[model samples]
Target: MTREYKRNGNVNLFACFQPLAGWRHMELTLSRTKIDFAKQMKNLVDIYFRSADVILWIVDNLNIHNPAAMG
Candidate 1:
């Protein structure tokens, strides 16, 4: 048990699903910074979810996932 805990070579996965239509989307990135999250959101809305009149988004209580991040 001499092995120490290490945190290298990890990646973040972002995904969403629509059960009604059995549709889903996912992306992977090295990190989950504000800029990366903002880009992911823009892609989701402007491209993937463009057909919807409005996007009722929800997320965990992550500090980065705020209105300020979107700006």
Candidate 2:
């Protein structure tokens, strides 16, 4: 699933994909600004993917792309 939202002058775009018959999961999120991306990625990793082993992230060539962004 994909979703987009704007609040307090920030734009957020996110996608969540789940495997059909396994425990695999992937999530992607893009924000109009780097700060929003950092905040959202932190929340997502902490809440939904804390125990994940292999995380596959597909992100754009934005300046905010950081290794610390993923759990």
* 4-46: candidate 1 lDDT, tens digit per residue: 9888788878887777889888899999788888998899888
> Per-residue lDDT for 4-51 in model 2, tens only?
886765444654555654544444444455666666667557877789
- Model 2 clashing residue pairs (backbone): none
Worst lDDT run of 10 residues, candidate 1, spans 55-64
Per-candidate Cα lDDT values, in order, are 0.86, 0.61
**Candidate No. with top lDDT:** 1
Q: What ranges in model 1 sit over 4 Å off?
A: 1-3
Candidate 2, residue 55: CA error in Å?
1.6
